[model samples]
Target chain A: MPLNDQLPALNREFIAHFGEMGSRWGINRTVGQIYALLFLSPKPLCADEIAESLEFSRSNVSMGLKELQAWRLVRLRHVPGDRREYFGAPDDVWEIFRVLAEERRRREVEPTLTMLRSALQETPATDDERHAQERMRQMHEFISRLMIWFDDVQKLAPETAVQLMSMGSMVTRVLEAKDRLTGRNTKKQSSPS
Target chain B: MPLNDQLPALNREFIAHFGEMGSRWGINRTVGQIYALLFLSPKPLCADEIAESLEFSRSNVSMGLKELQAWRLVRLRHVPGDRREYFGAPDDVWEIFRVLAEERRRREVEPTLTMLRSALQETPATDDERHAQERMRQMHEFISRLMIWFDDVQKLAPETAVQLMSMGSMVTRVLEAKDRLTGRNTKKQSSPS
Candidate 1:
């Protein structure tokens, strides 16, 4: 398929912008473009279609699809009676978000957590070392707490997560109510006194 | 100062790892190393000290510091009776997180929002274009909602945000309680019934 023939100007612009945005965020430009094309396509697209539509080499499309698959950002499906593999993004945008979050946590956050833990295990031999260890401890604790909260949030069904997010300021109000029920002051604390 | 004299072996390892991590995340390795060094330093470090400690060229150190300053991730300070400027990370890790979130929103998220908005304004000339516009609308709505929620959270005192996060599973419980109070079932909704 001719790229200009199939993809309208608006679609082409959006795909190009998406590709640029992806590269800025550490994703490969071609992979981003491929994902953008598949995301907007109403039907699953085979590798040949993606290559032809994006004007990317077959090898480039293959590599991009492989990377997307590894990130779990795209799904592979076999169209009925068709032997070639087809790729598509999840229908729900939230599902795409869930995959991105989970993958980032696994690839980046988990390793950082490990590094912090190991640093904490090393005994400090000097005042400077002691101070560094303290800093690492704080970092580790903060990350640990965040991960726990994230895991809990991830456990919620996607629809429930959407409902909870839709709550918006109501969630803050709920926290305030909890504080009131526990008899803790909601006022900002500026000092110990 | 000697390149390897003041920094302990553990510090060297940590700083090196941080540089690697930074590169993986689209940050320059030198910048990451400089930031990590400053983060663990007991006092603000001068450019010469950072260059020597990290074994980086003076020019590289200068460029890295400039980038860090732009990101608002490092502070310039002058020690008493000292002419040269020194750099340090914020004492509070949470403060660093706040700066990072703010800077990312300003640099990356806001521009993408603009692009999505512009795409949404264009009239679709075909069903395919219409579907693509619909996808863009979902993305724009999701991002807008997230930014609003983030702005609200950012307004919360750091301690309050920590408290809210520390609530962990209790947050879900609070949401369930609110739903119950409002006479809504807590069962997970797979679809609108």
Candidate 2:
């Protein structure tokens, strides 16, 4: 039974869009489609149901689920009386976001940070090396600062994080006011957009 | 002359690393190598120097520079009296981050937002459609909030932004204190991991 035959037009379109977007981001198309379908599913779906819904082969569905689990994008469950495992996306969108941000930091960012730290530790034997080392230091410092801030925000309850984002320039205003009092605004970092 | 022969060991290693990373991110290996070489040069470098240093063909270097310029990763320059064009990365790492962030948002994030908006606009004709629409609404809301925060922060002076990040959860504390005073701390968004 092809469950996709019963899918609402909107569901097909939504799943298709995510399939395209996911492929662009290095995830395979079938994996993206499976995740999108699972994401919008009103209840947990077993692998067979998943295959039928997306018209994916059983093996493909299994592999896609494995990839999604590796990305922490989906969770597994045992439906009490059923012998098959069921999979589902986290209910809260914020939770999905946290998993993605943290996972990407682990996969993509950690490698570069590791490379940078090692590069910075090497003693430069030439002027070119010295200049490159300076650039690396700046890169490492900025990324580390950004990551620390990320860790702090992720620790906050989602509501608190949302509130902070909505507060907008209120935080920057505080910095500006402190700068005014301390006369620390002399040097400006200008960037042409 | 093969300028790669003159490359400092550190510079060679740095260029090699970026080349590998770039390919993983969809940018080609040669383009990444070209950008890496230009980035480390003490002065703006012409296409010939770039080709020689990366051991890339003349056509490859030209194409890479064009791609880099499109990504806004490198700027085109004219040497004082030389007819040949030179290219260089922005001297400020912060500025490079800004360009990369903005470019990625334009290329990747905007399309998803557009799709979500369109999906939300369609009238739901089924229960499945209704559920899918609700999910799309949540996605749009969260992404819009994040983009707004990014815009607000990008408007700040680099030093101010650095100060804000280094403040390390101070902003979250303000929200926490407010929640405590308002008696609005009851509904927690629980997330696993």
Candidate 3:
């Protein structure tokens, strides 16, 4: 089937959006497009199939698939009587979200924390360095605490996670109400209970 | 103060990680470092201060500042008696989060939604397009509903928002449990709400 005839408007739109989002997330345009294809595909698609369907170079598809695997975004399947592998997205979007958050925290946040820890060890003789280190300490501690909570939230029931992610829009309002109700405007001192 | 003396380990780590994350998030290395600096600084820093302190090129600093302003990541301030403009980040991280979320939704999600809407207007007559469109409808509806929930989450109480963000690691475990308990294995029937 002709590519255009096979991919409806909705699919095209999805592909385009995913492509753009990929760029925002620091991935290449083609990487995003391939992911979108896998996401919308009902059955597993091989590298060649994806390349041919998307009209992208086989090497590009190969590279994108490798990165996707690194990110744990795609899974491989073997068709009976066939040696080649195919790819598919996980069944749950929440799972994808989990992988994304975890991967980012690991890749971006955790390493930074390590560096901050070592930096905090150095003594400061001057007020400027002292002040700067103070700021760094706050950030390190704050991010660390937040990471702990993320670990905890990940353990919550799936319904709870959905409720929380859905709470994205309502977050500020909730904070405001909590402020008025508790008279605590700064960070919460919620200790382990 | 000399840059070496002023840059704490934490700050250095932040700069390094932000530089790496910048590429992932579609921003430049220097730009991310600059934002990291702004984020931790108690007072606004001038272009010269930023340039001298971070050791980035003047032109790069200029471009980075322009981009930061466009993102609303920093605000301009003038000393009561001075003409030099200082740039500062919002004190509240939640505010920063709000801005980032809204901006990303606009830049990434909204455009995709627009594309999907336009694509949905076309009819899917063939099996391939029919399958593709069906998947597209599912994804489009999912993303749309998810964004609505995000808007709601944005308005959530600040403390609640922090509490939610703080969930960290627990986020994954809880959702997994919910998946098993509810037997919500399939994507078709699960409403994000």
Off by over 4 Å in 2: A1-3, A158-193, B1-5, B158-193
Candidate 3, residue A174: how far the Cα is off, in Å:
12
User: Lowest-scoring 10 consecutive residues by lDDT in candidate 3 chain A?
Assistant: A168-177
Candidate 1 lDDT tens digits, B1-193: 2237668766876787788789877798889889999999999999999988888899999999999999999999988898999999988777788889899998778988898899999999999999999988877887787787677666654574455444445546655654545456544332221
Work out the TM-score per prediction.
Answer: 0.89, 0.83, 0.78
lDDT of 1 at B190: 29
CA displacement after TM-score superposition, residue A101 of candidate 1 (Å): 0.7
Cα deviation of A18 in candidate 1 (Å)?
A: 1.7
lDDT tens digits by residue: candidate 2, A43-129: 899999988888889999999999999999999999999999999998777778888888888877898899889989899988878
> Which residue runs of candidate 1 sit more than 4 Å off their true CA positions?
A1-5, A160-165, A183-193, B1-5, B158-170, B176-193
Complex DockQ per candidate:
0.40, 0.30, 0.30
Better of 1 and 3 by lDDT: 1
Once model 1 is optimally superposed onto the true structure by TM-score, how far is the C-alpha of residue A158 displaced, in angstroms?
Answer: 3.7
In order, the TM-score of chain B in each prediction is 0.85, 0.82, 0.80
lDDT for residue A171 in candidate 3, whole number 0-100? 33
Model 2 CAPRI quality = acceptable
Ranking of candidates on TM-score, top first: 1, 2, 3
lDDT of 3 by residue, B68-94 (tens): 998889999998888888999876655
